[model samples]
Target: MSVVRAGGDGRTEADGTGRAGLRTLLRAADGVRIDVAYRPGPGGREGRGGPDVIVVAHGFTGDLDRPHIRRIAAGFARRAAVVTFTFRGHGRSGGRSTVGDREVLDLAAAVAWARSLGHRRVATVGFSMGGSVVLRHAALHGGGDPDTDAGRTARTRTDAVVSVSGPARWFYRGTAPMRRVHWLVTRPAGRVVGRYGLRTRIHDKDWDPVPLSPVQAVPLIAPTPLLIVHGDRDPYFPLDHPRMLATAGAGAADLWLEQGMGHAEHATTDALVARIGEWLEKRG
Candidate 1:
């Protein structure tokens, strides 16, 4: 594994134009080589002393350079250091998708790397499968009173988490169309595509979906700020998922239901960016 610097005072001005640099390396625990992108704070007054760090995880079958990933990273880079990465088997990263189980470790490694660069206050923004990994990481690491239902251990703690179009339940509860879609992607045919190192599906009979359930982990993120953003029209993760997450988290979370939005597209909205920026400012 190798680390490459993308932008910094010496590299580029913090004008939101610096591209995310890629770092190719293997995760210590699983030996999966992953591709990471670092978008450093811009130089001069605007780039000086940014927030802790914001680590971004993309949805299933997504890459580090996905348009949504770049958009979100740029949005946060205006205020903080942003790190985006592809999980193993996706994009330029190594290994096949382990669903969301091992990806948590991948995120943990990224967080550790960010902190090593002197970022103390860390936040995670995850979409779809990436969101599930963040929730699981927080549940295991976020220092909360133990909950037996999830059977999780605290792994890493973050100041805030933004989950967009992430489902609380891995298995479909009410969405028939989504269930059919998930099944098609997780089946053997999906695995065949995955063999070619492509992200195929989130569900597979060989893979246990229980570990990817964010609903079970919501309560554990108590006291840590949570932002649950879901599109009212998202077919994959219906509106109910965020509602249930908010209800479970109570005061610990804020829900943003975007009208006529779907899945990751909500991140591209200007209003959403302003809301998130405002939230970060208030928190800071």
Candidate 2:
């Protein structure tokens, strides 16, 4: 488990399970230090050797060491190199979480690192908040070749994007789960609970101009491969959320309505993950 530092970029270590794991720290666009991991596919499928790399983004309160997160990454590792990281305000990353807004920057940093490692292709898989981040990341960083930040952000662009159990809009409090989640995000007591009980540091300020919703982001992801995976039994965001996202994509995205599945990382199965890997292998 000992990792050798390669340079200021990060360090490399062997997981000893036939998967190559490199753990490192990356700075987000705003300079937040993000903890990132690159897990080489078990078959050594890298560079031009495989379809592409997969960058994994976990749900709120989830981190790199979470068993569920690890499982998802492991599942993808069977198909391609995987990148996993802690969002700002979560786990070992510095700065507080702005929920899903600034998270796009964190995701961008991870994708850039994966590309820097020689992986020409990279896909993003995210759950819940992470899911929203992926959609917005693709929209903001995927299109355009401008010379501005939008262009530089292309370093974070992804070939394919998968969003599991993500919400379509912001400020949604329709369901009981979402109501409680709002409580956690908006209440001081809830922030205490998130910091102590969940190990997630939430920011107190709200979005200044408010970022684009997933539905809005999906349309911009056009021509770029997008997959929206939602559970039929999800409590946080109902079927309508995924439907809205799919519709917004205007036939450019694929929607998977998983039967009997619940929500987010905990409810995701290895079979579903493997299926996603198969999609990435072909579509990425």
Candidate 3:
């Protein structure tokens, strides 16, 4: 589809399907260009009376074009406008991935762009690594202290937030999937595989001060309407992760321990995504 760029902020509709997609490039806190796709809900743009916007953040090794990612976007589009983007190292975005640390800036930029698009109510839905990023983004931007560069860029103002199959702590390698993930993020050969085989540009260094974990960030998201969905059969993280997040939120968070589900986008059904859309709609 051919997209017309009217200005740095103006979007060009590219999707001919009823769900019109406006493609744009947003700049992250570190000035990395992030590729963004905004799909108008059934109602269309806000000016034309469209529904609120829901930003969908993909997991590790996934991008805007990933089948699962697109499916999530499509599922949300049925209820509200959907914004999907490529994190710094994934798809057509610039810069390498710092895993979940600097990636918060990526989510921040996307949320800020969605707000700039005139959507008064903006909600974020993240999967796996993206799930962790959403939790941190809401905390950092929920009118709290701007401690880091990503925090400074996060003007959260998000109406609601969803975290799917995210880890509670950092440097966790208890599970086989997480162990393999650590190997991919820590070794040179693993980086090569990530860069070539997975098209995910991973960094060699480790977190200096170590960013806030998901459980730590959940409390700050209080009164912001948080939904934490994890699978009982998830191989990456056990039910404890979501339970801890829910506990941290006190009465502010909603936990959905999906039975028989796996992890992230692959395991999340389209019906579940649609249900999430409905939940966001009610929150708005």
The lDDT per prediction is 0.69, 0.88, 0.84
* Candidate 2, poorest ten consecutive residues by summed lDDT: 143-152
**Model 3 Cα lDDT, one tens digit per residue, 1-284:** 66677677656776667334688788987899999988887764444322388898899999998988988888887777789999989878899999999998898889888877777677889999999999998888775322233544334556689999999988888899899999999999999999999999987888998999888999988788899999999999988889889999988899899999999999999889877876776665
- Give TM-scores for every candidate, taking all chains together and pairing residue i with residue i: 0.80, 0.93, 0.90
Residue lDDT tens for model 2, 1-284: 76777787777877768445788888998999999998887654544332568999999988998999988888888787888999999999999999999999999999888988887778899999999999999999875432234557656788889999999999999999999989999999999999999999999998899999898899888787888999999989999999999999888899999999999999999999998887777674
- Give the alpha carbon lDDT tens digit for every residue of 1-284 in model 1: 23345444122223335343445453635677667757775454343432457888888778876776777777777777788888866776777677677788788777766765666677888888888888878776775322222323222456678887887877674777566555546677656665564554233445543474688889988777788888888877777788888888867888888888877744447667657756755665
Candidate 1: segments with Cα more than 4 A from true spot? 1-22, 26-28, 43-50, 143-155, 194-205, 265-267
**Model 1 TM-score (2 dp):** 0.80
| Top TM-score model | 2
**Residue 95 in candidate 3 has what lDDT?**
91
Question: Measured by C-alpha RMSD in angstroms, how accurate is candidate 3?
Answer: 3.9
Candidate 1 Cα lDDT to native: 0.69
Deviating ranges (above 4 Å) for candidate 3: 1-11, 16-19, 44-51, 144-155
Ranking by TM-score: 2, 3, 1
Which model scores highest in lDDT? Answer: 2
Candidate 3 lDDT for residue 107: 89
